[model samples]
Target: MRYLTGYSEAVRAQMQAIHARQGLGRLLLARYPAPHGMRTDRALHAFVTELKTEHLRRAPPIDKVLYDSKLQVVQHALGLHTAISRKQGARLKASREIRIASVFKDVPHDFLQMIVVHELAHLKERDHDRAFYQLCESMEPRYHQLELDLRLYLTHLEATGERLWSGSGSSGAHAGADPQPAAGGRL
Candidate 1:
């Protein structure tokens, strides 16, 4: 699948077999049955801030954290971390923001956490190098497994156009919602 380009042919074939049997969604649901109820932008901001506080306390502060409908999963931009500069009188201020794709709003908590951990890692290591992955793993012990599962979820979505999780507290209510105002804070 396009989402699994980095995986080996054998792994891809295994995934294909799972898809052939329509077990992708079942496998994911068995692993993660519930969604983490951080639905609103305010909630997302708090969730991200807590993680940042616990892991990267010395890194640059995050000015905003919200679900962005503009991010397309096909492009591999599940989440983004940006530093925006502004001129506050004579001094230039840099504001860091993290935007997660709306599709993640309906996924498992571990999937969302993996994406946030990746973006949070950017606060220190800018590139996707060894140090960046090390930071991600430090923040979440199951980082790699969650990432692979997320990719599998994306592959299943791209193939069937069906969502495995959808209901109250886990629906797509905020999937295309507008970006809320910055939840300004420093940890």
Candidate 2:
């Protein structure tokens, strides 16, 4: 339905079947594994910092990074970037802040990376046109795929009233981390 609008009919049918299953939550949990616990503001700041260092080295530094519970995904966003200007003595200075949805605290690492890369790209390109997406891809090569997967994830959440990784930490298809106890596979 609402979340599947961008997908083709065939894809929607398949996903709907998945959604209609007795324990869609279990299926999703099997796929996504566990949510991450970059729960603290400091941890989030460090995480964003690493992404910036890896991809946007020449871009302006971010003054702050936070995971805000006030950010709701159904509102059509997973992250936000803001430019703030202030008066310092006689001059005006600017800084940027990035806020990710607190809901991301428990998703897979790749999804977090996608959101971080997206917000970071805004520092360079202010529009959601071709150039902005190009920049996003430059930052994360698998950007498009991860984004689609994340959308499917959101669809699952909306349909099931479930949190995919409601239990422990991230341990999924992502390579580095060891597999966690299933929310029962690796989203």
Best by TM-score: 1
lDDT (Cα) of model 2: 0.70
The residue-level lDDT of candidate 2 at 171 comes to 29
Tens digit per residue, CA lDDT, model 2, 1-187: 4555555667667767866774556655666676666879899999999989988899999999998776663334678899999999999899899988877887888888888888899899887767887888888887776665676676666654555675543322111111111111112
Give the range of the ten consecutive residues with the poorest summed lDDT in model 2. 177-186
Error of 1 at 65 (Å): 0.8
Candidate 2 clashes between residue pairs 3 or more apart in a chain or in different chains: 30-185, 31-187, 32-187, 35-106, 36-106, 173-186
Cα RMSD for predicted model 2: 8.2
lDDT (Cα, tens digit) per residue for candidate 1, span 54-99? 9999998999999987676333477888999999999999999999
What lDDT is reached at residue 53 by model 1?
96
The runs of at least 3 residues in candidate 1 whose Cα sits more than 4 Å from the true structure, single-residue gaps closed, are 73-76, 167-187
lDDT of each: 0.76, 0.70
Q: Per-prediction TM-score, please?
A: 0.86, 0.80
